[model samples]
Structures are given as C-alpha cells and as structure tokens.
Target: GEEVAQTPKHLVRGEGQKAKLYCAPIKGHSYVFWYQQVLKNEFKFLISFQNENVFDETGMPKERFSAKCLPNSPCSLEIQATKLEDSAVYFCASSQLGPTSIGYTFGSGTRLTVV
Candidate 1:
C-alpha cells in the first residue's frame, strides 16, 4: 500500500529563521501538492508539482515559501525568514491523473510555529 509521510510533527522556529518541512508522496504518483492551513484561513493550496517540474505555484507566498519535488525523494517546502504569521500546518498531498474531482491523499502535516 502507499502512504504519505511527514516529519517532526511539530516545529518551533525563531522569527527570521528558516523553516523546512518534508513529505513523501505515495509511490507511483507523479503529482504532488502542498497546502497551508492557518488559524483562520481555510486550507489553501500552496503549490503543485508534476514530477520534477513545477505545475502550479501561483498560490505560493511570494516572499517566503518555496517547494520542490526531487527524483526518488519526497517533496519539501522551505520557508525563509519565517514570520509569526507563518505558523500553520503544512500538508503535502498527492493524486493520480485520473480525476481532479477525486480527493487527494494527504500527509498528517508538519505543524510549524514561528515565535
């Protein structure tokens, strides 16, 4: 069976520091997605990748967030110059090519806190 994995369930970083979160999508899947859920914000799409190329990144925060999907490696989201507002749960998800209406498989998420 396939599964998504996340590390360090919780993270606390000082303001202006860097925050890195990781995710392993299910094997055989090519589309990986990242999302952020803050205290008041609904789950918002952060980025999407097809294999090693970025498919969509419009939802990524312009100043501080970046993500990548490397070969044989889990995808990662890195936040530079973390801000207090950056505290949230970062989820990594994946989906097969069949249908967009179908839901995706998501990791438990890395809960990040910038203090």
Candidate 2:
C-alpha cells in the first residue's frame, strides 16, 4: 500500500502514436517525480511535483509532451505523436515532504517501445 504503483509493465507504440503512462504514488505523498532512461543508460528527468517542473525542454515538454500530478488520481505522463527516440523506461518516484525530503518511494517503472 505504501509503494508506488505503475500500470502496464510494457508498452508498444508506433511512431506518431500516443503513449500514456500512469503512476500511483503512495497515498498522501505530496510530491511526484518522473524520469526517462534512454538507450544509452542515461536518465533524463521528465517532470515532477508538487510544483510540477519540467527539467529539460530538449528532452521533453514538446508540444506533444505533457505530465500531471492530480489529486484523487494517479499522476500521468502523456506523449502525443511519439517519436522513436521516446522509447525508454519511464520512472515515477514520490516524496512525502517535497523534493527536499530524503524519503521517496519509486515504482518499478514503465517500459515504452516505439517502432
């Protein structure tokens, strides 16, 4: 019940298809974090909350990319017209006391494959 939960362990999408992933953080957690691990084993920060900041515009936040951490629902990351470069493992981690807090729970993550 305290662990972060992510749906659809794997996703397959064609280029230009929409890809939407969901992450349910530990209930009552105030902050959520999303990251993308590219093929090179480098992690790219996608977005995070409670302030909801997009770390890198070049990596994401394109017109087709969006993320949200809403109350009463799991946080979501959506990419419209996904490109082949979008294929990566997306991670969602939640914090109890904002980013400053050391305690964070991370989900196993969702693997997205674009062809």
Candidate 3:
C-alpha cells in the first residue's frame, strides 16, 4: 500500500497572488489526480495525469490554472492569480490503472486562502 503526499499544509495569499501546490504520487502508481474542495460535501476534479501525461482535464479552468506531473519529480498545481473564490482545499490523489477493489489514496490537502 502507498499514499499520496501533499506539501505545504496551508497557504495564504492576497488577491492576484500566485499559488503553487505540490504533490507526490504514491510510489509505483502511475495516475495522479487533483481536486478542489470549496464546500464540505463537494469536490471538483481539476485534473489528472497518467505517467506524466494528462489523462483527463474536463473540470479544470482554462485560464490561470495549470498542473504538471513529471516523472522523478513531485507533481504541481499552480494558479497564476489568486481570487477570493479560489480559496479552497486542494487534494492530491494517486491510483493505478485497472480494476481494483481499493481505489485512489488521497492526501490531506493544502488549504489555500485568498484574502
């Protein structure tokens, strides 16, 4: 069993500031995912990577947000400009392809606050 690791437990920035979040996918896992949680019961899937390649990104914003999952390097999600509405907890998850009873393993997340 492996676990996804997210760094910088918290982050705070002023409006228009840049925010960068880092994630390390579980070892031996090829898939990485990023999610944004604004409300207690809702999760917005931002992006996903399969072995350094983007697998799905239907929910990601077209502007101001970008992500990278590079081999041998920690994955990163960057927001070029922060906004009040962008304040949320960002979570990283990792999983392998194929059918498995157990699914993704998620990190604790980074709480980003924009003031």
Please, what is the whole-model Cα lDDT of each candidate in the order they appear?
Answer: 0.87, 0.83, 0.90
Off by over 4 Å in 3: 98-101
Ranking the candidates on lDDT from highest down gives 3, 1, 2
Which of the two candidates, 1 or 2, achieves a greater lDDT against the reference? Answer: 1
Q: Write the per-residue lDDT of candidate 1 for residues 24-115, one digit (tens) a residue.
A: 88888788899899965689988898887898999998788888899988788999999999999988888777226365888998999999
Q: How far off is residue 14 in model 3, in Å?
A: 0.7
Q: Which parts of model 1 are misplaced by more than 4 Å?
A: 98-103
Reference-based TM-score of each model: 0.92, 0.87, 0.94
Residue-wise lDDT of candidate 3 within 1-115, one digit each (tens)?
3778898999999999999999998898888889999998999999988889998888889698999988799999999889999999999988876223267889999999999
Work out how many backbone clashes candidate 3 has.
0
lDDT value for candidate 2?
Answer: 0.83
Of candidates 3 and 2, the better by TM-score: 3
Best of the candidates, TM-score: 3
Which ranges in model 2 have alpha carbons more than 4 Å from their true place? 51-59
TM-score of 3: 0.94
After aligning candidate 2 to the native by TM-score, how far in Å is the CA of 96 from where it should be?
0.5
Q: For residues 11-52, could you state the per-residue lDDT of candidate 2 as single tens digits? A: 999999999999999887778888898765688876677734
Q: Name the better of 2 and 3 by lDDT.
A: 3
